[model samples]
Target chain A: MNNPLLSIQSQYWAVRDYLSPEFVAAGDFLTFKFPVWQWEKGDPSRARDFLPHDKQYLITRNVPCLRRATAVNYTDADEDAEKLLSFLDEAEEVAGPDGKPRGDDDWVATHIGRGQLPYLRITPLPTQPLANLNIKDTADEQIDEIPDMDEIPDMDDEAVGLEEEDDAVRIVHPSAAEVNSTAGQNLLQVRTYDCLISYDKHYQTPRFWLYGYDEPLADSAEQNPLTPAQVFQDVPADYAFKTMTMEAFPHSGQQLASVHPCKHASVMKKFIDRMEAAQPTEGEAAPLTSGSKKGKWGIGGMVRKVTGGSAPPADKKEKEPSGDGEGSSGVQVDFYLVIFLKFIASIVPTIEVDSTTATAL
Target chain B: MAPLQFQPLSSQPTPSFWSALNSLKLDKLKLDDSEQPMEAWLEESREIHDREKGGTIGVSGSVGLGSGAFGQESGERPPAGSVELKGVFKNYNTIEEFKATETKKEIFNSVADSILASFETNAPQLDTFLLVTFADLKKYIYHYWFAFPAVVSKPAWEIEEGGLVAAEDQLVAEARKLADDLSNRSGALLVRGPAGQRTAAPVKDATAFFEGVPSSERIVAFHDPSHLPDAPGWPVRNVLFYLASKHGLSDVTILCLRSGSSSRIGRVSLPGPLSAEKPTFVGWERNKIGKLGSRVADLGPMMDPARLADQAV
Candidate 1:
């Protein structure tokens, strides 16, 4: 279809609707295959010693389906500073065991973790059964029978004009063209937080068990590997989970510590609201579906008209529709995951500490 | 301090601090009402008779009235469930007085300063909320996130009809994106008019107003219902409760409404993570509610964590 000059939000909804449940669920690590990056001498990525196999580490266990290659890259061309701000805004400000005053013990970690393992409490993604899927259908059989774009309704115009100030939704997901753009090549692998779910017996509330790691990738000269102890210094005293304690896993053999609770559920609920707001309204027109279009309004007809009455290139016309065939769900799941992580990052306990202070020493 | 030691879930036997407190038998007083039924009556009689001579009790009054010396012969009556509060009407009186003495700019500055000052002192460390009501002719709602400077923030101190709508839209957009981020959600509420001016106001539609503001996740709402005209005189207690229930919030730190007549703000029961059965209520200036400064941290999730442990197990 002709590019409808869709805004970031419109694009986000298109991508969300384009995905099916099976594709989102397929984001599990069992079937993940990493894309090869350019190797350089003395690069940290060469550190095979600390690199745990995919299954061994918690970060890689539930790999997000959307990779840098498949997703749309929305980073602005101008303002590298703004891009960095976005990164810093969304990066987990963890103070692991590596920073400041070589103390007898790390107070920051102990204070927040309530134990050796500091939890990263993630809000679970909202899961809905596919519209066409049935319980009895086999996975292989159902994959081929996914619905056409025409079947899905568009967002309601009234919903778009919702006067609520809280209706703003940011689209961080990259589209196929955007991802392939020149600016997308240098993008860094987004950091994934390591955490386990735990419980606070006193309040009887669920808690995140933060497990710190060095960095996102092995090869990176600019980034510093964060020790588990270093992650706590950045945590503010008032975060909700900062006051929780959890039972250590059977094999961890870690000591118990006090916790400082952070109210992360509030953050999670906000994400849930955003997803709710982005939902497609009933009876709205499907913008890109050819079946819904008439005459020259169709993408092919529009492309033909643009090409000055000459036939459009066969290869260009053959390019499958925006969200169809393989990897669309992977793209969708990855996009949602990124959004979730960004929301999670915005609330994580990260208090700025002055390096010049005596406390740092 | 020594490092806290971790133990496996199966091996840990210590009860949580909350569980230990709950186990105590502090519900009923040691002395029963039946045991001390007449004990209170005897103490009261002694006080009346123990005074010095010519204490203005029996010297000027009649010595005989029926069988008793004094006319107040009936037994003490039990306390009333609710009192006839000098609130909405009192507030109206106060607003009139305020308008007579203070300019609109002064009222705005004082109200804004009161709210900003509260963020440092009265505000809870987490999940703070406040609602400031004013008696303005134009009905506008101004909101701010405490993380930003209270002054020069969007929907400035001055009341603007267009700004109120713009502020609502901005808040809704931010709330949608950030969800519960402190920088995006926690802030003040500036409502035009005092508690009683209910007709044709933006805030009359409780659902829309409550939903528009970040009531569900706000840590503080600086309420000042100062200049409401023709009001029925009801406190903004119902609106506060509505915001609390939206997020299933159990604990919230609210600023009591200020009256034009009194310098002192009304009292609100700032409880320590109160149970749902006993909700927080705002009291009049003289009749303060719960204890002062019962500040609490964010209570986190509403559900029991034991169920989560079971599910994980």
Candidate 2:
């Protein structure tokens, strides 16, 4: 654990070949390449100021993708290859105009290969095999269980049994860096446990390559499997590439059908039908409520009245008592007889009738 | 009757008058062949002068009479009484001393307020007033003094020292050396006479000439309501009023230039002719336009009728 910072610095040096001089100069001014999170904290207002205001720090992981050997070779052999070569050569010529070439220049030459040399190959570690190697197998008998744990079954034995049940399962742990200063003069400490078995150089490029892996001997050369010419040589052009032309899918025609069949059409249709049935018939009106007229009252007026907390004034109430005979219980009464008796008493032309009525009573 | 003592025997008796006597004398000497020569008459006049010791009057009296007669001979009338009095007394007395008075700080503040009020009352609101002050009448005099010659004559610096001459005799002699130097240095000489002449008119009163120049170029006055009077060396109040009257600038702002400092602090809005309201005053301490949290004094229309009516009683 060389402070981990040194390792990070070395990683920066490794990728320095890819960066421009201006970028390197900028990096020299900055302590490190700012992470995206840190970059986002930059305030535009203080941009005019010399110092950056944001103090928060962030770390970012760097993962390099390897260029295929065939692509590199093709690019070199092609007519346009001279352009790329010239650019690289010009970059090299300008690298150390007055002094010896820096380490980055050497690294660039090695990665891209100098003159007629082959390009570097990179392969990532076989994660599955490495993880499997970490699992202990107690069934081998050479593995012994802990003497104090009679109640507890051997964990190694259980892990081996579980591995048998699902070969994909594995336990993983961090590995130490594989420093090989004697073999290579380079200061970088390569991780040997994570190294891949793939060849470092091939006549044709690999399907996928990771940076920094095993080198193959010159005598063990084999036919490249990942070349496009080799992979598609037997198939017809249309089938091999799957042509997607405008003529095949014209604008006037319906949109191209999905390659995967739609399984839920019937369910969708049922739902649509149910929704259509639930829709109201024409001319049917919606029911009105007190809330519907709330807008007319307005928030201010409503708040005033509600907060006042008093029954509405009698005059303010619009409901009036009805004069019709209908009441709490509807009862038909002799309105004509009552009116006639009142008339007989008020005007004595009705007095004779009133006297006769009294005698009859 | 007196003439009878000398020679009374003529039958006409000299007609009892000089004409008769002169006729008798003419008869006595009668034998005319030619007119009398003017020389004899002149001799006789000389004889009379000699006898009278400078004619009937003394030499001084005769000289005085002669000068008086010459004076009376000219038809030009004397100046009217009031005009003469004005020229001889009033104008001569006070023209040099006439100058604008120094307004009190409080009066300036009030003026600023009034100008602001006027701006609020009027339309087409004015925003700012730029006041340029001269130290005193001297500076104002200098500007006009320099400007007049620059306008009227060929630049004095353009003319050679001896080659250039002024039109007026007074200036010619009085500023002879100055004119020469001015001419050599390409200075302007305010020559008079006709457009192209050797003679130049006498220089009029410089102050009056300055006062007569259009006020626009000489002074720019603006009334800003928001200007503070107490601000050092800041003539916010006076400037506001001057601009209001001079430029008819309403709602003009007054900026205070601090003493020993070029920075502006207080702003006064001068009211227009139509405005009678007070100008809004804001100090530099209240707001900084360039810096954060600086307050700005906003003096817009003060009494907007519509806004006033819109307010609930």
Interface RMSD of 1: 32.8
Instruction: Score candidate 1 by DockQ.
Output: 0.01
Best by TM-score: 1
Report, for all candidates in order, the number of backbone clashes.
Answer: 83, 43
Give per-model TM-scores: 0.19, 0.11
- Residue B184, model 2: lDDT of 26
Query: How far is each candidate from the true structure, as Cα RMSD in Å?
Result: 32.3, 56.8
Displacement of the residue A15 alpha carbon in candidate 2, Å? 10
Native-to-model Cα distance after best TM-score fit, residue A250 in candidate 2, in Å: 40
Model 1's TM-score against the true structure: 0.19
lDDT (C-alpha) at residue A51 in model 2: 26
- The window of 10 residues in a row where model 1 chain B has the poorest summed lDDT is B39-48
